[model samples]
Target: MDYSQLRFVVEIVETGSISKAASNLFISQPNLSNQIANLEKILGKNIFYRSNRGVTLTSYGVEVYSYAKALVEQYAMVEKKLMTRSNENKIKIASFGSEVINSQFFEICKRYNENNYEFNLCECGVEAAIQKVNMRDCDVALIIYSDFQQNKLGQLLTAQELELKNLFQGQLKIHVSQKYPLSKKSNITRKDLEGLFHVKKAYLFEGMFSLDYELQFLGIPENQKTILANGNKTYNDALHNLPSFAIEIDWKCNKALPSDLNRIPYENKNLPITCGLVKRKNEFLKEELSFFVEKLIDAYG
Candidate 1:
């Protein structure tokens, strides 16, 4: 039935007379009476007992008034919830490193948002980031190049199942702790590192695994090389205790080294490394994720 009629019934009961209710509603009393008559017809029950004493509601009218008022309130509440959720979907983004993002990326997302889009941001490691895509937990995954490309590293991307999109590539160099007696050398030859205690930074999961495999190509025996702790804590401590090198993009290569920690070229010419971004083969890509990747490519390409 018409919700307006429900309101009319409620107003008439409050004002104690159709004439008073019509004045409050700014509607003609005749029009108000017709609406009440229509509502009673739809409900198949008489709602009011009419007389010079104004109107009193029957039992059925009381029940409908309670339910109708509740229904109108709930309907308004549902509309509000839907509006909030719609606003949130404008943009959704998940990325690995802070350095990975650039201005072009932000500009793209900003434009989308200006055009009325919602966004969600998730910061995670390369491997975990990709899982967000596979599980559909996120619309797009911004992952590290090494983690995205190397299957044995952690979770392997199915080239056929998901599109592998490239973003940018950069070089990671071998560094040394300055405290080491040999730290003074701007460049260390492969022979100079043959017997020194050595460490390398790697991820806790697939990054370490792939680094282990790649080291074999460097002729470093498994027993000779140490996988430094995954994150910054382990990276700093390992550098303090032993001769280790961190391999990261060139930008990160310029940070101030520990007083004794020296940045040096790898003694070996054949240090195997490559870093970039990736996405699923055929999945519908997220606009923000795409924008972020494009920015990375434009900056580092």
Candidate 2:
């Protein structure tokens, strides 16, 4: 089949509806349906089982879709290599944490400039970052999740056909202003900050799986005096100005922390943090992207 039809199948699987995929592909629904129907006839197998909800891939359709996706990626790579030299030097990255962006990201960008490449970094939640990579909008994604979330996150990455590489693992710690009483302790427990306000950084796409979920898994009570901050500056302000505490991984807070704030290791063996890089599965990394990935491994791994 033609590359256009292959792309149509992949898009249909991605959107899970012919109407949605047609809208995205800028084609009429009837035309798209006709194309898929012709493809199935050529293959002599029904590719999708239709229902009110949407389309579900049949068993054989799964194999066809897999090969089609790889072919599409390969074709795109060839076209990009041959025709997109001007855009080749640009790398797009999405990240979940400001700490990662401020620390490793800037350093990587500086090194990338040595090769005369340009890069863009977007700060978003894990799901949004994954979507950017899956949709080929970004070359890579950097995200941090608690060890407790490993299984769920793994399933998510698998569903999106993304590959993950571990950059760092850190123990969870509490960040509090130096003036706060809990800051005096070398280590703190859940009980120590019972009455103090907890500054929770609001995530864009955390869903039901997040730091709060991890805390609940650790048997910690939900923060009673909670304040939500939409961004890093506001989160830091809450920690500095108010008698509040925030939880973060040790390595992330090791740098870019205010002088007035201190990071105290929380005495919980159950809560660990993992930071990593993600990219499309089986996709070839361009020269600049490969170089940057190595720099990240050297710096953090």
Candidate 3:
């Protein structure tokens, strides 16, 4: 309800504990708890599920924390003093890997005064990631592609003088809400997803993008419904709030609410999905960039 309450939500989620957030905020635990309780009262919904171990976001809490974190960061951007820009510490990386990589990048970036350096971490598809690296806009990128697209991907990399370092492989999976009957299964077939709507993200590659491109490319049929989600929040909200399901490769790393979710490898498509790093063939990463690469390699392991 208030600016401080938004700060409280962001801090708690970051620390993963109320008492920790209170300590970081220089306030008593009871005062922190009461402030959050008051905010929940104003919003008319519980923002967290508490236990002795700690707290996790309720479905509504996910939405609140997202907005709260964004608002808090936005508030920090309201500055009256103007400063000149410097390109001295620019660190740019694009990823199609996992949200975990984002966390790692930020954790390392925290070691610096942000005003003294600049960084850009982008979440993007394979082609875009390759293009960024090829154009030298980014020193490197973490990306993924279906083995089905490997040859074409290889040719593109060759033409662009890009190289790939394979890190890990995973089967693309279908994640459904726990209430769905498919959730009980160890694997899901195309027939099982016949009637329920499928959630997917639309990515732009070379100024061309499509909503059903992925399914069509994989030779899968979209008989029921297909929703075009543009970001994490929309994609997640559809799964938690509806009987919809998502077909994705990174079941291991999405920062979604575990709001009764289940994942089963999609038996319908046994595509070998590869997550890897992309960089210019002759590129030698600088010190900070090399640190990021090491962090990503450790994270993928």
**How well does model 2 score by local distance difference test?**
0.79
Shift in Å, residue 104, candidate 3: 1.8
Candidate 2 per-residue C-alpha lDDT over 197-299 given as tens digits, one digit per residue, 9 for 90 to 100: 8887677325645676666665555766888887888988889888788876666433443467787876744466777889998888877667765655554
Each candidate: what lDDT?
0.60, 0.79, 0.75
lDDT of 1 by residue, 133-166 (tens): 6776666655545433366433466632444555
- Residue 22's lDDT within candidate 3 is 94
* All candidates: TM-score: 0.48, 0.63, 0.62
Score candidate 2 by TM-score against the native.
Answer: 0.63
RMSD over all Cα atoms, model 1: 12.6
Evaluated at residue 93, the lDDT of candidate 3 is 90
The prediction achieving the highest lDDT against the true structure is 2
Tens digit per residue, CA lDDT, model 3, 1-301? 8999999999999999999999999999999999999999999999999998999999999999999988887777753222435557778898863556767788668865466688898877666777788877888888777655677778888998888888777665677888777789987776777777777765522223222455565555565587767777787788877777887664344334334666677665665567778888877877887777676566656
Clashes of each: 16, 0, 0
Q: Between the candidate structures 1 and 3, which one is better when assessed by lDDT?
A: 3
Sliding window of 10 residues with minimal summed lDDT for model 3? 204-213
In model 2, the runs with Cα more than 4 Å from the true position are 1-88, 98-101, 114-118, 252-259, 268-270
On TM-score, the stronger of 1 and 2 is: 2
